[model samples]
Target: MPDLPILLIVVVGIALVFDFTNGAHDSANAIATIVSTKVLSPLTAVLMAGALNLLGAFLGESVAHTIGSGIVQPEMVAGSQGLVLAALLGAIFWNLLTWYLGIPSSSSHALIGGLIGAAVAYGGWDAPLYGSIGAKVIVPLLLSPLAGFLSGYLLMVLLSWLVVRSTPGRVNFLFKKLQIVSSAFMATSHGLNDAQKTMGIITLALFTFHEIPEMAVPFWVKLACALAMGLGTASGGWKIVKTMGHKIFKLEPIHGFAAETAAAAVICTASAMGAPISTTHTISTTVIGVGASKRLSAVRWGVAGRLVVAWVLTIPAAALVSALCYWFLAVTGLAV
Candidate 1:
């Protein structure tokens, strides 16, 4: 091991803070339906989401690896702690802002966008991994929600058709129990996809500091990020929960189960593919699909439009903030 600088330690701490915020903001993705449908109390749902998220964190490193080298080169950015800090600030601020406004935004994109801005600030036109960002982050951000929506819609249609002969009361009773399991699945997938991002950022820092010659994420990094996110999830965010559970669609137990299952499958697949797709996007689209399956009118187009606006703006907004922050650092002669 090398001598760790105070800056490195501080960076680690800040990364954990971002991880915590990601978990808290995204907890709504996992528990919204289960809580909304009366399948689980809020406390019970959050506790389960938190625990499962932690457990899920142990399952994959692909997303971490994607983020580590996918956005900006750690080696290039490592010497400039100010730049890194600026990027983190951009992401953290965005997460808090969206959470406060009860809008579900992508924590994944915020970090990536911040990194893009910081890299552009530090490297000008020579920013590392620019191509990778378009291929990995932007492409996935656009497509995953479409996938989620389609899958959720198709699943809901199939399930609805299968159970069409069942009484409404009976279907509701069955799906209520099913929602508990679906929530757990979604929470676990959420951890697998989201926590890995912090792990990547931390590992990227380690590489930049030359503590590690490569961008390999260590076990401690993974565990720390995982735990941070889980605790955040346990803390929960009910405001966003309302937005996800009720505003996107009027979820009954049946809709909740379908939406969760559809979203979980999409997220887990993306995790396996090393794509850092947004749980917020996936779940929101899945819910929208489930909403449409009942009737187009069941989905709140106005609220959905607002969320789409937030999604469209997240990357650019975080990037602009990060770019400005890095500019401040540069102009002040504090970049390194």
Candidate 2:
């Protein structure tokens, strides 16, 4: 038990590291559209996203609790420092890889997959909370991107038709103003959902070591998670920004507005339900939707296809890495 407290501290640190990576990896979601459309400078977009993301932390905590306790059994997580470390390492490595590749993969899924992989490696069939896991993790993963795609597509078509006769200059002027409002919503949704993943992991670590009561997420922890992600977003991930903003599609102000609005809505909906979906997936798919509205050829299916491959691989890759880390630690006698 004495060792458990020390291990818990280590896991908390790892969780924050994961949170930081999450921000860097997913910052593309918040800034891509605005930057792509030239509605905002990259620097300005990131700063806005970071600030609103921090502000968003104050919005809610339901999602945080679900991630901390709803995924796996606390009793099993107890005395499992090796497992936690493995899971974190797995997710971290994947984030770095995808970030470098300019693929906006699912940070949320990577973390969840890492945990599942680590738990399965260590616990086999005894991994806790599979039923809830399916409902919360897998179901949302499938639906969020699709929801973003449809929403963005529909919104863009409607907006385009409504302003069909308007001058391009006037349309740009109006959406430029509207982008600020929608971007805030997107950033806020980001904080409400993405920040909660870290909060959950931290809370889970605390509960694993018996530092908290009944796996509850505390106010202070929520603030810290939000701050970590916001800070990381402020620091920025320029490589991904370039890819998301320029490579996938040619975007204008209206496209940016539609994509951001759609992404924000999907993310916020998932957050309110305590479900953690990938902000990366949601925004990327939305961007595609906007681009596709122009024509199939306009969307650059090649780049997007590669991104899809990365998204599909994220969970298993992180999970495998975490499992390997767990095995190495266990065999080396670092975790018992």
Candidate 3:
């Protein structure tokens, strides 16, 4: 068995690794519309997103606190490095698998699912605080994407009707310039919401092991977690970018601006309420809304259906992986 100190370090390292994966996996949410619309090149788009993500990290810490406390009981989590390790591995593996498949699923759901799965595997179904999780996670997840779709659909319809008399070139030219603002909004919302998840996990680990006080995620903890996520976003997740930017919708500047703006609005509102929503789901649904606004034929329902399947499977897939890892750790008596 590894020494307790070394085991703690390893667990924390795994947590950060999971955080990095979260950033790379979700970076597409921030830049997909901009890239698809040619508002920014791949490299410039990622760089812009990375910078805004870093700036947005300081916006709020409520979501972090929620994740740290809302899912599992603090007592169940404490002194269990193996459990935390299992959770991180589960989330990381699911993220990589989805990215490889070019699926835009929820990294947030993956993380929570991992933790709940491992916790249930070890402690049974009642191990998780299902009430808190239901109120905070499950409900919001269901509503957010639907909200994004409706909002994006309405925005596009309004924009189109308002500019119907304008030439296509004039509308495209105007919206191309406006896409910059929407892109910034998306990036900022992505950072504020997604990075806090990593912060939540890290703080949960620290609190569990008595490295930090209960109920408070330290300032330094927030800064370091935010920085790690920002760096990961800066590196970009190129594979999934193509999937989000081109596969779901062939967007023009107008579609991009409307979809991104709608997604940003939903995400930022959720962030203020400390809900950790899936930015991927929000943005993808928005794009679908935008595409459908032109006509139902303009949207590719077949491809969109596949993505929804991936989202449905993400949580359970991550949980299964985490549960297996936990079983391995328990059998070997490793310090993970």
Local accuracy of candidate 3 as per-residue lDDT tens digits, 1-336: 777668778877887777777788888998888887888898998888888988888789989987888888877767776777788899999998888877888999999998888887677787799998988898988999899999999999999999999999999999999999999999999989988887888788787677876868788777877787788888888878888788888899999999999999999999999888899999999999988899999888998999899888988899899999988888889733
| Residue pair clashes in candidate 1 | none
| Least accurate 10 contiguous residues by lDDT in model 3 | 74-83
User: lDDT for every model?
Assistant: 0.90, 0.85, 0.86
- Root-mean-square deviation of each candidate, in angstroms? 2.0, 1.5, 1.3
lDDT for each residue of candidate 1 in 202-313, tens digit (9 for 90 to 100)? 8887777778878888999988988999999999999999999888887899999999999999999999999999999999999999999889999999999999999999
- TM per candidate: 0.97, 0.96, 0.97
Candidate 2 residue-wise lDDT at 128: 52
Give the runs in model 3 whose Cα sits over 4 Å from its true position.
Answer: none
Top lDDT model: 1
Q: How would you encode candidate 2's per-residue C-alpha lDDT over 233-266 as one tens digit per residue?
A: 8888888988888888888888889999999999
